[model samples]
Target: MKNLILLHGALGHSSNFEPYESFLSQHFNVHKVLFHGHGGSEIPAAGLSIELYVEQLQQYLEQQELNDIYVFGYSMGGYVAMCHALQYPGKITSILTLATKLNWTIEGAAKEVKMLEPELIESKVPRYAAQLMTLHGENHWKQLLPAIATLMTRLAVKPLLTQTQYESLNLPVQMMVGDKDAMVSIDETLFATKNIPNANFAVLPDTKHPIEMARPELLIGLMKDFWKI
Candidate 1:
């Protein structure tokens, strides 16, 4: 079986991939990574950043002694996976990213950061806030919100990956976005796909930004097809 690593989105934990793990394991050796400050992991002293997550991933790969691995990343995880591939070439054989926001602008990031307010989320989206608390810790979840906001703000100023870098990727890459995904635009995904020499793009119908809401059959089918397993 091939080795496959599943990476969750921002504010998400390794457990979020549980739903698909069993099915994926039947075809590949499935592994999950929890970024710093997520899934009950202690926040690094330097806090959350794309560079930190990429380094964490590199450490995980080295510790496991894994190579030529396949990666499936969702949202922010997708962004981190690409960065890791760029930093450590030949480690990842291929990458599949879903609903990842590729185009980050100051205005766009500011809007996203504003939504990370703990109080506002607690007041307006109590269920989501409660989910965050459950995923992280009851007390620590609030701290994570600000840290993630800072990360987004930094991305707006300087993204980890540039157009030339995308073009330089030597491995196969597939970028997928849901047609109904409001957070990630299809245009941006397509643009990135076009830049990559060996890349493909796909759009899922009746899909949204949240991975939990995605139809399992459709997602798994795409993965199987991509991997030819």
Candidate 2:
């Protein structure tokens, strides 16, 4: 059986995959990573970039002496996982991404950054702000808030993944999405699949951008199939 590492999206913590971890554990040994600056973990003042995040994960895998692992990432985490596979080929046996797309264009990413700027400037006390803050204590939040905004702005300036870059990865990849996913359109995802040498795509019926709310069973089934366990 392959060891598995699970990564969550922006504003999400390790607990985001709690609902499905037990199910996946039956098939693979699972370890969930809490993104840097997230879940109350120590973070650099500069916060995180996709590149930094992948390095952190790579170090973790190396320290643990874990290889031949499977990676399952959701949203932003999915992007990081994809990059890792490209940078460190043959290390990851298979990759599964949920509700994520590889076509992160500079124009589109900038628009996303524009949207988040207002939210960051609004104030840390807002309920929406709380959603991004997983750890307790105001000290950690105070330290992490600025980093998050800065990182968001940085991402806006540069697209994390591009079609040409994604085509470079030859790993087996499976993308699981929801039919009602408003964040990423199926058409956009299809464009990404065009160049991937070994890729599988699945859409859950009556689902939305947030897979948690749609149907967990569908995701679980896909995981089982992908892992063949």
Candidate 3:
């Protein structure tokens, strides 16, 4: 059986993949990876960049001798996946990304960082705020916010993945975005698919960001089709 590695988005942990475990495990060896400073793994106070996350993932694959596998990355994790594919060709069998932003610029990134406002989340989305706090330590969630903002700010200056790089990656890649995803634009998602050599794009209707929670069935269907399981 082929191995299926699930990479969670920023501010999320391996637990985010629990919903897909049972279903995907029946078809392949499903593995959920927690990026550095996420889940119960060692937390880096300064947080991690996409490159660092790629290195950690590479080491994990090496330790398990998982040279070839399917990598499904969500949001930030997807950016990491593209970097990994570019750096280590022939190592990844395929890549699937959902709700991953493909465009970045310093000004745009800085504006996005504003949404990470602490008071806003704690006030508007208290449930999510509570979850973040639980995922991180009691008050460590706030610390993670600034670190994430810093990474985004840096990405604006230098993105982890670029159009030229995406066009050069020979491996198959499938990117999906929700129809109502306000965070990531459909145009950019389509742009990525068009640049990649063997890539496909899907727009999930009646869905929004976080497809895992918005429409898990559609996500599973896409995976089944992509992997042909």
Kindly report the root-mean-square deviation of model 3 from the true structure over all alpha carbons: 1.5
Which candidate has the highest TM-score of all? 1
Query: lDDT tens digits, residues 1-229, model 1?
Result: 6789999999988887777888899888898998888867788788799999899999999999987699999999999999998999889999999999989999999999999999999999999999999999998999998999999999999987779989888899989999999899999999999999999889999999999899888988898888887
Model 3 scores a TM of 0.94
lDDT by residue (tens digit), candidate 3, 2-97? 888899888888888777888988987877788776654565765668888889889989988885599989999888888988898888999999
Candidate 2 residue-wise lDDT, 1-229, digit = tens: 6689999876567787878887888878888888888877788755688888889889989988898899989987888898888888888888898888555556665555554543453474466556554442445665555565566566656766677766887888887777888777788677666667788888788888764675677787887787776
Runs of candidate 1 exceeding 4 Å displacement: none
TM-score of each: 0.98, 0.85, 0.94
Local accuracy by lDDT, each model: 0.91, 0.75, 0.84
* Candidate 2: residue pairs that collide: none
Which portions of model 2 miss their true places by more than 4 Å?
114-130, 134-146
Consecutive 10-residue window with the lowest summed lDDT within model 1: 38-47
Candidate 3: 10-residue stretch with minimal lDDT? 37-46
lDDT of 3: 0.84
